[model samples]
Target chain A: MIAPALHLDGSARYDGTPVFSDLSLRVPAGEWTCLLGPSGVGKSTILRLFAGADTGADFDGSFGADDGAPLDGRMALMAQDDLLLPWLDLRANVAIGARLRGEAPDLARAEATLARVGLAGMETRRPAELSGGQRQRVALARTLMEDRPIVLLDEPFSALDARTRSQMQDLTAETLAARTVLLVTHDPAEAARLGHHILIMGPNSVTPVAPPAGPIPRPVDAADVLGAQADLLRQLRGLPE
Target chain B: MSGWRAGILSALLGVAVWQAVVWATGLPRFILPGPGLVATTIWKSRALIAEHALITMTEVIAGLILGTVLGALSAVGLAASKWARTLVRPMLVFSQAIPVFALAPILTLWFGYGLGSKVVMALIIIYFPVTSSFFDALMRPNRDWIGLARVMGASPARIMWHIRIPAALPGLASGVRLAAVYAPIGAIIGEWVGASKGLGYLMLLANGRAKTDLMFAALIVLAVFTILIHAVVSRIATRLLERY
Candidate 1:
């Protein structure tokens, strides 16, 4: 599917407290847009808003596909929690979207998706039997099986150990390559490594942060990547440099 | 130890304790029959006890099936609709507050002195526990899974069928296990209130005739039956839990 760019211009309030106001952002079509900010800045809320999920907040805004189409049924989401149903094995979990929608799941396709996520031949393993990283891979496989044009990830790799987190970043960057991806993260290095267009969201405003010049799934030790990571860190910390 | 071996050992211990109590109390044989006397009576009246045991078993099983189905449906309905929750949950709680055991005589009067009254009694006794536990679990599904299903564009019915129901199976299993133990109580009470045949009715008959040994045998059969049902239900519940 050709990914459509998305636009959100509005404000939201949670329990009568303002989450964000006058927030305007663009997720350029078919590219990675990383949203970075401190906790409670509503970065994940924006992702929720775009994914058509309940944000537990009253939102008054215009958010839609750049193609002027409704975003429903064209989106998939991955959260820090893998959200695999414990009762179902890996393949069934990967095909859960179709099953939940009352469609006959394509088991062959689900197996292939698992293989794509490097979990080949583990189709019958329950979520409990797998390591945390393996479970996240199953989640990734589920997300990929949906094949939606827009994918929203809320700190999907933050729970992993340092090494596993970096590995996951690389896999996700490669797998979700052509989709309209919006990643919400608090990790500066993550944004620097994967974001094609980065936006640092403060309490009330959204500002675009320039990424280091390179192809995404960027080398971890690259000089510009480290520089960009440090700069994003400083910017987020309100530390002028 | 194997389960059967442990169970046999426990039964032996219980019998020994019962025999000791009988010897210590020196109660009249009619008042407290010893294990040996009860065993002899059981063997001699095996056919008679079996006939009555069959009736009570039928009542308990029928009640269990009916209660489990009705309770499961009520729980799912409550979970699925806010209207059902608002309108029915209070009534369910109110029903529980009315002690169900006290309703046995009335149930017998309405359903008559046969199997129907016994079954209805069993159903009423177990309905609330099954509904309450299953409904509570249904209401509190894993939030993240529900969110994920919603984002996948699942309809409410589809979500309930594929997610909520399966997630709540363990809860439902627990309810059924509880119902197994409680079902015999309902059936026996209904039989006690008014019945032509059943283990409960036989015990009452034997007591009136001062055939205490026969009454003791009947009581032992009832106890053994209840324990057997509980063990079977527990095994099934554990398997269901493991599978789901």
Candidate 2:
């Protein structure tokens, strides 16, 4: 699949306060771009803008695919909350997008995706019956089942413990390799681990930082990842590097 | 203890207390029938009481089914549209402001002194709780679930049916439980206003004829029937909550 480049030139205001003004960025096709910032720097807002999910914000933007076609129905967003329906079991939850689209749920494919997310044999368990990490995995499976060309993630693995978070990061980086991805997170190390190119959003500007030349998920203890992590942290703290 | 055992024990204790009260009061059987006299009356008039009880039961069941269907639909309508909420909801609440007992005569006047009047009475009494409880639940669906559904491009109708309704079912179940207890009150009140063949009418006839023991027997039968209906509704509600 030839992934389309996403371009955005936008300004957004929340409650009459400017979040970002005249902000422009280009995401190359089929690459992972991580948006890293402090807690309230509007990283997730940018992702929401791309996903068209920020309905209440005063946003003025021109967004388009590289081919000049509309972007509707081509993007899927995995929000920070694992918003699994409480009434459905894991399999049905993963298949919800298909069901919502009025298509027959591909249960066999849903089961395979659940297994890929390491949620095998728990297809009958509801969200409330699972652990936090397990629920997050189910949410990930749901996003994967969407099978759209562009994916937006908002702090997708923040709920997982260290080991499971690493596993999920690796799995996502592998599974979503062929799609355009824009991820939002506050974790510098997570950005370093998964992002092919990292964009740091400061109070006034977004700065692009070069990461090490390796496919993610890079070894957490790898020398290149650690170096990029340090540089990312330095940029976040407003230090010259 | 399990529910049945506990219920049986409580009932036996209530009967013992009633017998003690009768012995202590030394009231005459005409004005205040003893437990023994009431018990004998119940056995002897079993056939008459059953006939009336069956009629009352039919009215209560019919009213419950009709009211629940209408209430559930009204709640869905209220949840689905702001216009419905603004227009219909106020009228529903206003209907309750005039006491339901007051409406019994009006309903009897409109529906006539038959099952129609009694069923409408029960329906009127039950409508508010079912609509209110279900509407509250539907209006406040889990925000995260709604967000996810929106992101997935679910239509508003789809979201309401697939997500909101299923999520709000426990609240609907609670409403049904309340309706079970209230249905009989509406039926009996309608019978009191005007009816020919129901427990309420039988009680009134026995009292007018100064048959205190027979009236007590009819009243006891009504009480037991109410408890049984409540138990059945509660059991179904519990199962629904568990499944969904």
Candidate 3:
């Protein structure tokens, strides 16, 4: 029995501002888990914390990955900003993580990954040359190159057009099939789109509020989802009052 | 568009007025040669003017390369370590404060009135602007970028090499342009103070021999050379920064 990737229990803050506190969650192996919250609820910070991004004393947590799981090196993270190297083209950017790890045949794999994103011809175009959607796709392609068990995605497709965003979600679902994916996003539609178990980050904490539990066959339809996006939005809206 | 054109036309008008003043006053050729006379003189002495111009241009290019390399290296060094910044920063600022005219004489005394002295002079003139500009650019507040890179576990070397260096391009380009203008001027000044060759030396020699035309020729050559260098460097940098 391959156990889950992580069991988290803790809190984090910023300059006396409570980001989220006393959070607990279980991220299983080979499953997509989306963390949903409104803007500034420290969803990104949790992704950061999970990715070992905590600087200073902002985080208090208990995180332990399953032993001997054979993750390719370790955790790989993607952030909200689409932090692709501006100097690199699509191909080079995709392979950067593998190159960092001294992985064999990095560029070849990076090229194939870029092809998966339909960016085959844009291997030489820099990040500044790419559109918002293209850049995010390139970033997703890059994250795939890491070949790691855990992939932390932080609002990666938030800037894309609806069509592109849905297509990207489809591509990511197909391509990142086996990874323990933790995606930080504000949009419930997106969380529903990913069709994973959900972790909703709350005012003072994050609670394990999975999407009705058990396997929900993904490429999930908006109407067939357990939580309607409008309901979630209203729930979020009514929380602080 | 009209405003820019008008400003340029006004400058040409100012030049025409200056030309008229020189002609009407009948000022001594040594004191203030007329524009027409200078133009004719430059045409006549173009070959000789070009030879001296090449010498000055070469010196300027060499000094520009050396000073920029030294300045950028110093900026990196200072940025890399607080100890180096403490030790070297005061000297750099103080060096800029000491009048270039004052420094020129001493440099001539040390490097013996030749290429070395002139190169050092050019270096002294353009070094501070480049060093300070690049230093400030390199250290510019990039909290988001720093946070991103740190979270990604980028090594310090990688962070500086990739992030800081590319981010500093705009400031570095401005500094390069400033240095390009001043580098030739510095070389000319050094040659004016003491040199066996170059347009500045030729201008002085031409003046002594009462060849006012030849002196004007040298001055025009200097102008063309400065424009050419600045344009070329700017184009190359812009192309390189396409990726940046």
| DockQ for each model | 0.79, 0.52, 0.19
Candidate 1: which stretches are off by over 4 Å? A239-241, B2-10
The reply for model 2, stretches above 4 Å from the true place, is A237-241
Over the full model, what C-alpha lDDT does candidate 1 score relative to the true structure? 0.93
Q: Rank the candidates by DockQ, best first.
A: 1, 2, 3
- Native-to-model Cα distance after best TM-score fit, residue A115 in candidate 3, in Å: 1.9
**Can you write out model 2's per-residue Cα lDDT over A127-197, one digit (the tens) per residue?**
99988878888888998998888888999988778888888888889888889898898889999999888
**1 versus 3: better DockQ goes to:** 1
DockQ category of candidate 2: medium
Candidate 2 all-Cα RMSD: 2.5
Query: How would you encode candidate 1's per-residue C-alpha lDDT over A1-241 as one tens digit per residue?
Result: 9899999999999999999999999999999999999988999889888877778999998999999988889999999999999999999999999998889999999999999989999999999999999999999999999999999999999999999999999999999999999999999999999999999999898889889998889999999999999999999999321
Across B1-244, the per-residue lDDT of candidate 2 in tens digits comes to: 5977998999899889988888899878888897788999999999999999999999999999999999999999999999988888788888889998888888999999989999999998998999999989999888767766766778889889889999999889999999999999999999999999999999999999999999999999999999899889989889878887
The sequence of per-residue lDDT tens digits that candidate 3 reaches over residues B1-244 is 8966996798689779979898789888777887777888888777877778878888898899999999888888888788988898898887777789887878888998778888888887888888889899998937556655554456666677767777787777778888998998789889989988899999999989988767877887788788779888888778877745
- Displacement of residue B46 (Cα, Å) in model 2 is 1.4
On residues A150-210, what C-alpha lDDT tens digit does candidate 3 reach at each position?
A: 7778887888888888788888877777778888898877776674677666787565554
* Candidate that scores best on lDDT: 1
Q: Chain A: TM-score in each candidate?
A: 0.98, 0.95, 0.85
Residue B80's C-alpha lDDT in candidate 3? 77
